[model samples]
Target: MTSAIPRITRRLVALLCLVAAPAAFADIVIGQVAPFTGPQAVTGKAMRAGAKLWLDEVNARGGIRGQKIKYVFRDDAQKPEETVRLVKEMIEQENPAAMIGTVGTSNLEALKQDGVLEKTRVSMFGAVSGATSIITARNMYPVKASYREEVERLFKQLGEMGRTKVGVVYQDDGLGRDALAGAQASAKTYGITLVAQSGYARNTTEVSNAVAEMVKQAPDVIFLAATTAAAIEFTSRYQAAGGRAGLFGMSIIDVQALLTKLGPDRARGFAFSVVLPTDDRQDREVVREYLRLRQNSKDTELSSRSLEGFIAARALTKAIERTASPTAANITETMDRGFETDVGGHRLTFGKGQTPSRYVDFAVLGNGGRLVR
Candidate 1:
């Protein structure tokens, strides 16, 4: 009962507190459209908490240039069409100065295809996708390393450890397609054999066939390029079938959530590639600050997704600080003019010919569900 309380608080705060700007309060407004209720809800919730924590802190300190920021978040339920609709509605009604924390490669692609970002000219930061389409889309800036980078890094490590026979489990969406391509490329580069591969439907955990396929291959390692829910389901089902492949996943797997659901026994030894420095990096001022704020808040768990949200918020705030009178156009222009800044120790630079940040760390689930470097 007590554990459920924090979950309820997070849900309420995510849905109500940032749903829309009060009509009376007028100031800086930023909006987001993401999955709040669906398979991806866990990712959405962590992102909301991390971004909101920084934004709330900014407001508590009297806001930027004495103007309070209004963060408006809407739910898309992990549907691409709904993402297009809700983002359009938010832009028309709220007139957000910018956008932040958009999730999913397909959702971002839907927005791009509909010209929502280009037409509205609102700069969006911290898009939770490493898909090439999103990275190249005009007015969309990604803060993390590309999915290709994450896959290649993992493959390189596997190659070093002489784990050459590998299989893949990915979603059949833009995110999955991008990652699968990366996996193929990385396998070729690392001299790892692509023994077998399987893909599940988007936004669903129906991975029985996929799991069966992987079990048959019995590769030395299986790379999971999937969402959190799908990853959890696959891990549970695969292990139950007596499959013994070394489970490795991309950053979207949400290590903290995995620990909670699968427990230490089943979840142990699974490795993950994280885009940000792990929580133990006390050397990073941003990591320290995030830890402090999380400990002080009602949020139940801390994960890379949450840290990603906070970092995205910090980057957007830095741009807002430089603009004369923050608006969609000026913020877009300010960010387009080669925006670069350091969030504590992690550095991000954006402009023409700029590659996304290339920082990734690997960790494995140790005893008691803690990450071991």
Candidate 2:
């Protein structure tokens, strides 16, 4: 009787362990490498927050296919070399099912230098860069408007407003070069003259010379293809020097960051293109959902950057759900086979269009740092 009792107790313990074990099924790991501790930290933080929001909701709802999703990220500190190393490390150790929201044009170029994605067969979704090189890559699927499209839109608006003379300030790197080319092409399309152009070194904000040059030209508007910090500096200096040209910037500029640094009074009228709807756009279902989730969480900062991250996660989540088996190849194949999802009235399509998302809007800093459409 004692032996029988011990056997029954052992069987009950085994059953409980099987029921309670969290790791019975492997997690679907996704990797991200972005600048978390460098000049681009502000953008990286928002991207992380946005992606985590949707992913948390998914995990709370029992995840996809009964397997929880695990997000693994590393800070590249805005260095291209570090980006490569960290991505390689994550693949070898974590074996991420896919990569999401890797930031920077130079970093993407570095990854492409050695055919990293091609050799590894890992597909990256929602890269933060709009450079032609990164967007046109074989395995990369972008979820935002390209720099060229952004420039064209800006120029088209300029043409409508009769602002013909335009100056371009670009970073002397892959990102800026790509945008400059786009700006040049858009200039021709919109009948705007390339009055004055200047290049600043990457990862640095020495824009005084560029400011002086642009102000000297006194163009109708200045198209900034620079980073957030650079944009703020250029705006502040340009305005202080009595330069009255409207400052139009790429989507890379974070409106929140600009307002924080320059304040509402200084930031007012500084316009920039946004690849996604602004946080205040509650008319869209995705915006409302994102705002609700953000309010429920500890994240307090709301900007287009974070919103973009949420949309990117939503797209990746849909891809994962659609795949019968969540391997890198399976996810990529599923996305390649004409994948599209309605993210609360905003549509993101892959394999059916030249770009994944055709949504682009513009906003300017209004009173008290508010985004005015």
Best candidate according to lDDT: 1
Error of 2 at 190 (Å): 1.7
Among residues 3 or more apart in sequence or in different chains, the pairs in candidate 2 whose N, CA or C atoms overlap within 3 Å are none
TM-score of each: 0.92, 0.92
lDDT by residue (tens digit), candidate 2, 280-339: 888999999998998899876445689888988988888888888888878877866777
Cand. 2 TM to true fold: 0.92
lDDT minimum window of 10 residues, candidate 1? 17-26
Q: What are the per-residue Cα lDDT tens digits for candidate 1 across 1-373?
A: 9999999999998777556634324589989898989999988878888899999999999998778998889999989999999989999999999998888999999989999888888988888899888888888877888898899999999999999999999999999999999999999999999898899999999999989999998999999999999999999999999999999999988888888899998999999998886678899999999889888888763466799889989989998888887889988888778777998889998864365599988999998887788
In terms of TM-score, the best-performing candidate is 2
For candidate 2, give the lDDT. 0.86
lDDT of 1 at 82: 97
Model 1 bad stretches (over 4 Å): 1-25, 301-304
How many clashes would you count in candidate 1? 0
Error of 2 at 144 (Å): 1.0
